[model samples]
Target chain A: MIRVQSEAFDAGAELNAFSTQAAGAGAVVSFTGVVRDVTGGLSGMEIEHYEGMTEKALGAIRADAMQRWELADSLVIHRFGRLEVGEVIMMVATASKHRKDAFEAAEFLMDYLKSRAPFWKKEITADGADWVASKDEDEDALSRW
Target chain B: MQVLYFAWVRERIGVPREEVETSAVTVNDLVVELRAREERYDAAFADTSALRVALDQELAEFDAPLSGVREVAFFPPMTGG
Candidate 1:
């Protein structure tokens, strides 16, 4: 499953729901990204996403993960729009018969989500706002898989 | 066809989307036509390397043909997640 929306979601609830859905799986791994104030003076973060393209990109990535890993099920839920510090930005969960597959798939999903998806983040602070630039490390990480 | 911009690209162009009529054959050609329109477009498209393009919601190269593409989007490298 893949979801892109502006509303916030409960990560615990989502994880539980996904685990329940992947009933017979022996292992499940999940990652949740939080809105952290990297800069102390930060007030909030504004996330802008391509409405029609966001879903499409996420779906493609999810499908790719499913194909590459021995997984029973997967879930990706990402939120957009104005978000305050400490809020959940996104989450990814993968279920498989073994711990290795679940762990690898979750990491793979996060790596792709960081660069491939069509979403931009703007850090808002007392001074003003600035668009978050793509890090070289993020791009370099893709070469592994 | 429709042209769309996002993030700082939209800020520079002053619009999120627009309808375009062009005889351009490829994504690069369409970009050149847009750049010739005004200073804002020119600035937004100043460096192709700093931007990414999509055709009909799928990512595409600048040299990709636009023969039947109905939508073209330009924006910076995504900083998602």
Candidate 2:
């Protein structure tokens, strides 16, 4: 499942629900990204996304992960709009019969989500707002798979 | 067709989207036409290397042909997740 929305969600509850739906899976790996306080230099974050494309991009990648890994199930939930410090920005959960598959799949999801998804993030600081640049490492990470 | 901008590109171009009538054959050709229209568009598209393009919501190359494409989007490299 892939969800793109402006509403905040409970990571704990989401993980629990994902685990339950994964059925006989023996391993579940999940990741949660939060708005870092940046030593209080950051006040908040604003996320902008392509309304029609965000969902399509996420679903395509989720399906790719399912085909690449031996996964029982997978979930991706990414939020948009104003997000305060410490707020959960996104979550990824993958369940499989082995830890290796679950772990690798989760990492793959994160890597692809960083660049392929059509969502942009701008950090709001005391001075002004700036869009986060795409990291070379993030692009390099994709060459692995 | 519709041309859309995002992030700083939208801010620079001063609008999120607009309808444009064009006969450009490729994304690069379209960029050239947009750059000719106004100073803001020229500024937003000043650096082709710093930009990314999508055709009908799918990522594509600047050299990608615009044939049969109804929507075009230009923005900086995505900073998602």
Candidate 3:
């Protein structure tokens, strides 16, 4: 499953739902990204995404993960628009018969989502706002898989 | 065809989307046409290496043919998660 929305979601509830739906899997691994206040005095973050393309890109990434790993199910939920600090930005969960598959798939999904997805984040502070630049480390992470 | 910009590219171009009519054959040619339009386009495209392009919502190379492409988007390297 893949979802791209502006509304906030409960990570715990979502995880439970995903686990319940991923029947027959022995191991499940999940990662949740939070809107942290990396800099002090930060007010909020604004996320902009290509509406038609966001879902398509996420679907492609999820499909790729499924092909690469022996999985029972997978889920990716990402939120856009204005989000305050401490909110959940996105989550990825993968289910497989073994822990190694689940862990590797989850990490692969996170790596691709960080650089391949078409979403841009802007950090808002008391002074002003600035677009978050893509880190070289993020791009370098893709070389592993 | 339709041209789209996102993030700082949109800010520089001052519009999210626009209809473009051109006889350009490839993404790079289309970019050249856009750069010739105004200073804003020139500045937005000043560093093609710092940007990325998509054709019909799928990532494409600058040398990719534009024929039959309905949408073209330009933006900086994604910072998603």
Candidate 4:
């Protein structure tokens, strides 16, 4: 499952849901991305995404993850709109028979989402607000995998 | 067609939303269609090098055809969390 939402989500609650859905899986790995107080010297963040298109882009990311890993189940949730620091901004859950598959799949999904998804984030700092672009390193990380 | 902009592309284009009509059939063709409209569009698309596109909300390649697509979006590489 994949979602692009505007409201915050409970990581524990979502993990429970994923575990419940992955009845036959032996391992589950998940990651929750939160709004950090600092990024590349920026103090805050504001995320923006095209509503209808965000969903489509995230779905493709999820589909690719499934194809790349032998995952029994997976879920991806991303929050849009204004977000305060320390709030949950995104989550990815992957379940497989072994921890390696689950962990690597989740990380791979996050890397692709960070670079290829349609969502854009703007950094708001003491100086000014500026739109954040995917870095060359970020792209290289995905390409290397 | 509905043309939407996101991130810095929206700021550079000076608008978040717009409606356009064109006979272009692919994402690249559509870029050409928008570029021909005015200088602002040309400037916005000046460097396709830094841009990416989506058709009907899904990430798509420049060669992807646009037939029956309801929405087209253009933005730089994502910085998603």
Candidate 5:
């Protein structure tokens, strides 16, 4: 499943929804990403995305994860538009028979999503606002894996 | 074709959306076409190192073919959490 929405989502509810349905899976690994108070020294974040394109991009990323990881299922949900601190911004769930596959797949998905997704985030700080750059470290991480 | 810009690229270009008609067959070719538009396009694409691309919303390579693509998007690397 893939969703790009403005409203904050319930991570616990989403994790339970994915895990409970994966009866054959022995392990379910999920990641919940929230709006942090500090990002690259910025105080707040505002994310913008083309709604239709955002969902389509996420669907493609999910499909790629499915091909790379042996999993029972996967779900990716991301929020767009303005977001406040401490709000749930995104989540990724991977169900697999082993913990390693499930955990690694979820991590891999998030790493790719960071640099590959269509969403753009602008940071508002005391000085002013600026769009965040795809960190070189992010690409390095993806390359190492 | 539909052209979309995001992040600093949008800010630098001064517009978020545009439509263009061109015969470019690859992403590299399209960038060359756009760069010819004006200083903003030239400056926005000055360094491919600072830019990334998506074709029909899927992350794509610079050398990727653009045939049959309805939308082409340009932006810097994403910094989403």
Candidate 6:
């Protein structure tokens, strides 16, 4: 499953729902990304995404992960628009028969989402608003898979 | 063709999307035409290395041929996840 919405979502509820759907799987791994105020200067973050392409890209990434791993099920929910600090921005859940497959698939989903997805984040601060630049490390992370 | 820009590229270009008529055969060729049109486009495309392009919503190289492409989008490297 893949979702791209402007409304906020409950990560815990989403995880539970995904786990329930993957009942046959013995291991379920999940990851949630929160809007962190690392510098304490961030008032909020604005996520911009291609309206038509965001879902398509996410679905492709999830499909790729499923193909590489023995995943029973997978879910990805990414929120857009204005998000305050500590708000949940996105989550990925993967269920597999083994712990390694579940964990690795979740990581793979994240790695691809970081760069391949069309979303862009802007940090709002008292000083000024600035778009977050892509990190070299994030691009390098894809080489592992 | 429909041309789109996102994030900083949109900010710099001063528009989110527009219709463009061009004889350019590649993404880079289109960039050159856009850059020649106005100061904003020139500034937005000053450094091609800082930008990424998509042909019909799929990631594409600047040198990729533009034939049959209905939509083209240009934006900075994504900061997602």
Q: What lDDT tens digits, residue by residue, belong to model 1 across residues A1-145?
A: 9999899999999999999989999899999999999869889999999998999999999999999999999999999999999999999999999899999999999999999999999999999999999999999999998
In model 4 chain B, which range of ten residues has the least summed lDDT? Answer: B53-62
Runs off by more than 4 Å, candidate 2: none
Per-residue lDDT for A1-145 in model 5, tens only? 8878888888999899888998789899988988776545556678987657677667777888888888999999888888777788899999999888899889988988887677788878889987776677888878866
Which model scores highest in DockQ? 1
Measured with C-alpha atoms, the lDDT of residue A60 in candidate 5 is 78
Per-prediction count of colliding residue pairs? 0, 0, 0, 1, 0, 0
Task: State model 6's lDDT.
Answer: 0.95
lDDT (Cα, 0-100) at A18 in candidate 2: 93
Q: Please, what are the lDDT tens digits per residue for candidate 2 over residues A28-89? A: 99999999986679999999999888998999999999999999999999999999999999
Model 6 has a DockQ score of 0.91
Query: Residue B12 of candidate 4: its Cα lDDT?
Result: 77
**What would the DockQ be for model 1?**
0.95
- Candidate 3: pairs in clash: none
Whole-model lDDT, model 2? 0.95
Better model by DockQ: candidate 1 vs candidate 2: 1
TM-score of each: 0.98, 0.99, 0.99, 0.85, 0.86, 0.99
**CAPRI verdict (incorrect, acceptable, medium, high) for model 3:** high
Worst 10 residues of 5 chain A by lDDT: A35-44
Candidate 2 docks with a DockQ of 0.92
lDDT by residue for model 1 (B1-81), tens: 999999999999999999999999999999899999999999999999999999999999999999999999999999998
Q: What value does the lDDT take at residue A132 in candidate 6?
A: 96
Kindly report which residue pairs in candidate 6 clash with one another.
Answer: none
